[model samples]
Target chain A: MTGSPVPPELYAEVLHFYARQMQALDGGDFESYAATFTADGTFKHSPKLPAAQTRQGITEALHEFHKKFDGDPVQRRHYFNHVVLEQQEDGSLSSTAYALVLTTRPGGRPDVGPSCVVNDVIVRDRGALRLKSRAVDHDQEFAAVAV
Target chain B: MTGSPVPPELYAEVLHFYARQMQALDGGDFESYAATFTADGTFKHSPKLPAAQTRQGITEALHEFHKKFDGDPVQRRHYFNHVVLEQQEDGSLSSTAYALVLTTRPGGRPDVGPSCVVNDVIVRDRGALRLKSRAVDHDQEFAAVAV
Candidate 1:
């Protein structure tokens, strides 16, 4: 349970992980995004949605998210802020962050989609940090009109 | 520079600081809230606004904020999440957090007010953490109707 400020090197690594993960997801590279997690990683987009466990499951979930708007020329951007990381006694890292999703439709102004609280458990595996579990809690229930 | 995870003690202190600061502000104890800053602390609510550079300036800003809705019975709640703390070489701690402000008017359902990215520089003054500078970057400009 170390509690000094996060070391510079580790801080850089954590930021790097987030950047890479966001880039992969934004680019629609599901495979690469899923690779950011552990082989048995689990992710819950919302409490109402079923948890996706396993790398394959994560990839499929992402596919479904994009599939909903298959033909629409929609652009989506995810912004994560206020990331707090704590190392647990068991040597895993616990992270909490706020996420804002923006959606823009063709010829339409961009609008804020949903704000979420993201909680994650990360572990070092083979010299790299990978997410073991991720739970996304939304500030409000998803609206039908949301992206 | 220590490359280790933040100590548990400092982590607990940081959390405590936020909890106390929020409670003080929500409770209308502007003095206590302003006291959380150093004598020469600075806070910029938004890039478009001037920075409040002194403890007296901070109090005045809060006073003005509350004065705007003096006659309305409104409830305001601030939710901060994803707090990331980094220790700097100069012994100051740099933190990044996401803030969500919710406002509810009498007999009205609660609505989200504004979301912000909070960047703060904290220093240990007399064995307690005090904010030296706080720059709040808003995700969007505030609407006239907002609290």
Candidate 2:
């Protein structure tokens, strides 16, 4: 809310973008999920995890990930909340939000995998908003290791 | 996005209002949390749960609810996302968002209690946004249950 007044449409657009990306991923439509990012976009769950270095990389990774749930009735959903957007001089946007990974299975209780923070660099490609990069850091990762 | 372009500011305001309310509740500032609702506000987690019929009622309920967490290292975080804002004819805003209740304990894995949908009726009170009503529907509760 500080600095010059920002157009309200930008806020809604930012949220709508996430709605599109997450739903596509949860629905197992990796192609639509990958469409939310630029060709050379990058995504990493954490510094300790392998990252997808491009749109195709993520799509392929998602396909592999989808295989893990085979024969089991399970669902994973990513929810982003408390988003804060900052405009960059490079005509990109820095979007920071709290993310929760939720898993649901038939007859079993839903589970929260982790509470994490997600940082995304969003850019306009062909007049559509797309992510340039995304990174996640989980709360448990902050705990000390016994090693 | 339909029925004549509404000011984008309204969209941002709706999201921000949720941000404030959720943080206040999670931070255990019941007074600040209660202030988010109107004097005649109503809140119910679900149709089967008890309802708070007024701001005063919710504040008292929160105080009683806080006692249940006594002596345990636990944290509850409410996350709201995938929000859609609609302008109503009565000058109020109808805000619908997904709600996730996440619980974390020291040295224990964080768990997701439920994936829920929250519908809030937000109205302006002395130029400030306030919730007139809030109702939640959880995914699990929708499943078939035997008597």
CAPRI tier of model 1: incorrect
lDDT of candidate 2 at residue B112, scale 0 to 100? 63
TM for every model, in the order presented, reads 0.61, 0.60
First chain TM-score, candidate 1: 0.89
Estimate, for each residue in A61-105, the C-alpha lDDT of model 2 and write its tens digit. Answer: 777866777776566668887789888888888989988787776
- The superposed Cα distance between candidate 2 and the true structure at residue A131, in angstroms, equals 11
lDDT of each residue in A1-147, candidate 1, tens digit only: 456566645655665466557646655788887888899999898898999989899999999978886766555556687778887899898999888876555434446768888899988887777899999988776544476
Q: List residue ranges in candidate 2 displaced over 4 A.
A: A1-11, A20-76, A81-101, A111-147, B1-6, B107-109, B143-147
lDDT of 2 at A68: 77
TM-score of 1: 0.61
As a whole number from 0 to 100, the lDDT of residue B94 in candidate 2 is 78
lDDT per residue as tens, model 1, B1-147: 112255545755776798899889887888898999999999897788899878899999999879987898887887775466777999998877656677899889876646665889999999889999999955544311121
